[model samples]
Target: MNSTRFTPADAAELYGIHNWSSGYFRVSDKGEVEVTPGPGLNAVLPDIVDEIVARGESLPVILRFPQVLAGRVRQLNEAFRTAMREYDYQGRYQGVFPIKVNQRRMVVETIASAGYEYAHGLEAGSKAELALCLAQNLHPDALLCCNGFKDDGFIKLALWGRSLGKNVVITLEKFSELERVLKVARQLGIRPAIGVRFKLNARGSGQWEESGGDQAKFGLNAGELLQVVERLRQEDMLDALVMLHTHIGSQITDIRRIKVAVREATQVYSDLVDEGAQVKYLNVGGGLGVDYDGSKTTFYASANYTLAEYAADVVYTVQEVCKSNEVRQPTIVSESGRALTAHHAVLVVPVIDVTGPTRGLQSIPEAAEDQHQIVKDLEEILANINTRNYREMYNDAVGDKETLHNLFNLGYLTLRDRARGEALFNAILQKLAKLVAGLAYVPDELEDLPKVLADKYICNFSLFQSLPDNWAIQALFPVTPLDRLDERPTRQGTLVDITCDSDGKIEKFIDLRDVKATLPLHDPGTRPYYLGIFLMGAYQDVLGSAHNLFGKVNEAHVTARPGGKHLVELFVRGQKARRLIESMGYEEDMLRGSIRAQVDRARAAGRLDDTQTVELEEDYGEELLGYTYLEYEE
Candidate 1:
């Protein structure tokens, strides 16, 4: 029996649990599969992968555990509920799934269904998103918030939602949007709740710092807020203005910054109520972050506070502010999309190849007549080097290379001499750089040279299709080999995606202090090596493009029961090549006909015999009916 005790760091390394644990995931002794604590992922993963393979799926698959999603929703609601009860706060805490984080059907549906008990809702930013939210969210009491820039069409959708008896809040990002909302509501004969987004001067900390402050793109200014109030009063719609909203940004790492924003936004809520605008809810838009590095430090992609601490801070701050201002404590609503959704999905891909620069050269060899002088000179420098004159000797050796290069170019030395001199010089530099690295005084240029010299692992996934944020925004996702945690990794390599473009490489990685150029992975072998891209459940799916015509990967939804039996359910296979072609504006039948015509032409040209042509045609026809990309095998 294999016995390996994995820490949270190991779980983060294996399953991509960067933040506090929400899902019930555990690794068994042998590490063959990471299972939910009950039935074990060992029983779950093989069944899931086998079912997918039986259906003829390929590598680079995304295994989504809906049980994890359900667990996250329950934890989020429980944290707030526990805080509310413990603090004796007067108002309720309700959470909405920000559809922007992940707009997939299974994810949204699972969150909606699991959160039905807590009245958990969905927040939509666009018309299409609104349609999705309305269709999936069957929770009658859950709030459906319509945010972002609104046009007449968007406002109409919000009003339409209100007519369906759903708790639809149209949050006005700008003063002009208020009139659109009022017009649409009047036309549709539905009184939709109104919320004004406040542009607070307070700023947040982390990658999404631009989400708040006076320079934020969304939200109404002081002047605009007052105008909106006057317009609501004149139109006899002040009663509909029931919610006040503000957002600091996403991935907030500083707890102090969140406290500051909550205080400011709470003051804004108090002022709205004091000015005769009915404000019953405070919507602190999503800023809760995940601790990507698991350090609990203030990094760009992480947070410093625990979920309970964050809830306590928000509730306690709001209660104090409202009490001091002589206003009723408003119900707290949070759209903490990333924190709730970033951990439920994991992308698994295989390492196909590894490459690096050449190695294994000491001093330049003393060859025949031509290269002997260069070798002799190199040996003399190595022998004469002393502690006091080592630096000067190294500099002098560098200058000799330039002189040797000129001599070779002018035909004064043979190519053999030049090669020997170059080899000798590089070997010396490598040794010096290693010594410098050991002394911890490596220059910036030399710091990444070791990684650059290491191999590049060609992974069987597309950066454009699987991890667009890493490619477009230079975002770093935690990547670690799945089954090799017990053994220490020895190879350092960059990850190259399966894209035809040169830019499809993942060289930037998340380190302890900052981003790095390469990751340390295991050496390749006969069996397949797989790496899981962590914390990608939030935004990678819907934002992914079919760049290079690579469509989505196969998806599996696993659920862990209480008794330890894992259930593996295939959600959807990825887009077929024919389906991808149809999506790109080509008719499937037309594409098939064109392929058949080419095969016939090849046969007619005598390039293929009768049997070969028949086999070729059959293969092409089967591929047209099959899924995109070929299956990856060892």
Candidate 2:
């Protein structure tokens, strides 16, 4: 019989960071989580947390590794290149980072700078994004694809991109958009390149599967696509139809679904080419899924294939379809935004407090003979717990606890008796939990005893503000301690945020089989305990809402040099109290003046002394500039 105690290394295997981190994160010798930009370099996350605290900054900081972003761009492009070479494919892979995934300036500029050599492009889905694309230093030969519903201004800006000597393609989602494209091109007197998003009957699979297929909100029907070609031909603008676009959905886990979509889109492209429409680019829009849970299954959060396998499937499918259609191999472009940026940043928040009996086995007070029968029964259950009778004892304890609650409500039991009953019941649960862990096979009745004994750790960040997907769609992101990987974690806890709402907590955590009810964590006795939420660089920042007025956390851009030296290139402060109030339409000056007036009125009425009045005014100013989060004192 072996009785090996579980350690922090066990936590790593449980969370699957080694499988999903893509060689960028590892456990250090000191048990701290180390973030790597490349070979021969790493950043200690706990040290960064220390530096942040030393600088008087708050918790819940988001650290962006631009090096990681660059590496991902290289990884994606290289995967395609390798696949193309292996298959001896005729067409080149031209990938574009969709701005909608992460529109932050540092993220977009890092992609532009790192992907210039591979001729990677940018995809904008709206006018604002088009303006952003226009300003970026993209490769002269790289593409600038304009998608989504377009107005005249949006169309004009895309045509202006062409005038500025960029390969800009305005993809038409509806038949009416064609007229807008033509009208804007005529007004600007610039030849506009166009693409058509054909609605694919093959639907995707996942949370966003509904965003694709025949009845999707975007994309043109078969009839509409034909009308676009025919109308362009009538106007002698057939040469302007340079690309065909279709997206099954975002975060597509099944590679089979991807191949089906590619084949369908390729057939549509070949049909248009056979009709004499000059389509030179087959834009297979993004569905490259990230393996969030490291399961590598078709589970909505996991991808069934690797980057190389995905590229091979895409390239081979397109090549085979075009070969059978007897059409020339068009260039393949993918807008893989999620897979590109999801690993580049991490959200680090501190566990400020705990709210359960994590200390275990507290001294239970004896119930008096005059107390209710339920309290006496709970005391009896606690006194008689043993291996053979633990199951029956636990059940009896549960029953007695319920009866004690009812007795308290019915005025039959005193508050002291109820309290003692709770403590005894909890203590019994802890003892049973320890015994259950040592058992090779626990009975099915008490299988969940250990989990039921887990604690609730209150972290210093808002779940809605930092991880909206977890709240909105139950998207799982990997979370673990940045330090203490060497020590055994005795506590299993679910994270509760500092928000007032009951829903602002994360109970489900990533697991190999399914989501676990709690996360394994160590006790944060007196030191600051930091938890890093990984793979949140994609849609989280842009989609995060200011729920409960908990604004964005401070952001830091960390750049790693070749010599392993790190630099915090930029630090954007989070929204302060005044800014948040102003964002909701209250004038800052007016609010300040009103506060000053109230203070003066109180002072004149002798409600405040001279020292108190000065302190009050100074405190008001300080509160305005204070971080919206709870500031911890050492």
**485: Cα error in model 1, Å:** 1.7
lDDT score, candidate 1 = 0.77
lDDT of 1 by residue, 446-539 (tens): 5666664567898888899889988887776777666655555665688988889898998877666666676767786886687777668888
Which portions of model 1 miss their true places by more than 4 Å?
A: 1-28, 31-56, 358-445, 561-565, 623-627
lDDT of 2 by residue, 569-625 (tens): 788888898888888999878988998899889999999988998898899889888
Model 1 per-residue lDDT at 585 = 93
Predicted model with the maximum lDDT: 2
The alpha-carbon deviation from the true structure for residue 428 of candidate 2, after best TM-score superposition, in angstroms, is 2.1
Pairs of residues at least 3 apart in sequence or in different chains that clash in candidate 2: none
lDDT against the true structure, each candidate: 0.77, 0.87
